[model samples]
Target: MRIVIVGTGNVATVLGRLIIAKGHDLVHIVGRTPEHTVPLAKEFNCSWSGFSELHVINADLIIIAISDNALLDSASTFHTNPVPVVHTAGSVSMDVLKNVSSHYGVFYPLQSLRREMMQIPEIPFLIDGNTPEMIALLENFSSTLSPFTEHAGDDQRLRLHAAAVIVSNFTNHLYALGE
Candidate 1:
């Protein structure tokens, strides 16, 4: 599948690498700044563009892996398209992408991801879509990236995100005390 990834952070970089490694075509990398986007695009050997140029790129899937705080405002910039559009956010609702495309969904990765990690960890994706068909399509696509995939609604994802935060924070606190 041909894919376009938005954002230049950990999630975007990690996911983009995974997509390309799986024999998929990474058509473009769109970010807020050229400084970050250009280098990532060079690494992927794909085109790079700012959010303003997003409408021109054609791809099978567009994944918005930006920060949760920027999602609402950034979502409005995406021109409506027929291709599937998804966000890798755990706390946000899938409806945030409704205006971005006719087919929109959530492609939330359940595990923590860091681009600098020496080994890629097993990521279980929690996915949801606007329609049943869209949900199925996201599930199948997610399966190609990870062996674990599940259908999760807005409430479920939000709850899981909260738990993940608590667990992460507590672990950090323990490490700090140990130190």
Candidate 2:
């Protein structure tokens, strides 16, 4: 599968590495900042572009791995893409991507991800699509990256995200206090 990843943060970098490692063609890397985007593109050996140039790129899949706050606004830049588009956001609704493409979905990774991590952790992907065909496509693609993948709707994903936040944050807070 040919893929284009947006954003230059942890999720983008990590996913880009995984996609390439899996023998998938990472066609392009798009982000708002060239400083970050260019370096990442170099690492992946793919073309780089700013958000404004997104429309020209062609890929089988486009993953918007940006932050939750930027998801909706970033999605607006896409003018009805033909390929399937997915976001790695847990809290944001899949509908936020409705206008971005005819086929849109959520590919939320339930586990915490950091670009600096020496080894990739087992990511439990919670995926959802606008249609059954889209869902199947996402599920099939996600399975290649991780063994643990499940279908999760908007409400379920949101709730799971909330719980994950509380658990992770609360555990860290306790450890801080212990220190």
Candidate 3:
């Protein structure tokens, strides 16, 4: 499977690594900056470009691993006609990509990430697609990476994201204070 990762942050880097490690082709890395995008693509031995090239690029799947706030704006940049478009965000709904592609979904990796972290964490994937067939494709794709794949719709994903923030963020803050 050829996957184009469209983000330069922790999620994109980590997931791109996983996909490459799984023997799939990372066709391109599309970030907002050449500095960020080029290096990430190099790590996977693939080509890369800025968000401006999204409409012209082609891939089996386009994964937008950017932050939620940037998602709406980013959606305006891609064309997912012959392929599917999925975002790795819990808080953001799949509708964000509805206008861009008929085949759209969410591929949220339910875990915290850090650029410094080298070890592959146990990532549970919460996936959803606009149609059942698309969802099945996402499910198969996710399961190839993690056995802990689940089908979570927009509402459940949002609630899980909120709880995740409370549990992970709040506890981390408390720990920092305690230390």
Q: How badly does each model clash, as a count of residue pairs?
A: 0, 0, 0
Tens-place lDDT per residue, model 2, 65-120, is 99998986667877537989999999999999898899999999898888996578
Q: In terms of TM-score, how similar is model 3 to the real structure?
A: 0.96
For model 1, the local distance difference test gives 0.90
| Per-residue lDDT of candidate 1, residues 44-162 (tens digit) | 99999999988888888899999998998779889748888999999999999888899999999887889896467778899999999899889888888899998999999999989
RMSD of 2: 1.0
Q: Deviation in angstroms for 96 in model 3? A: 0.7
- Models 1 onward score TM values of 0.97, 0.97, 0.96
Q: What are the Cα lDDT values of the candidates?
A: 0.90, 0.90, 0.88
Model 3 lDDT at residue 48 = 89
Judge candidate 2 at residue 65 and give its lDDT. 96
Which parts of model 3 have CA positions greater than 4 angstroms off? none
Please state the error at residue 169 of candidate 3 in Å.
1.2
Per-residue lDDT for 73-153 in model 3, tens only? 768767767689999989998999988788999999999977666888768999999999999899888878888998999
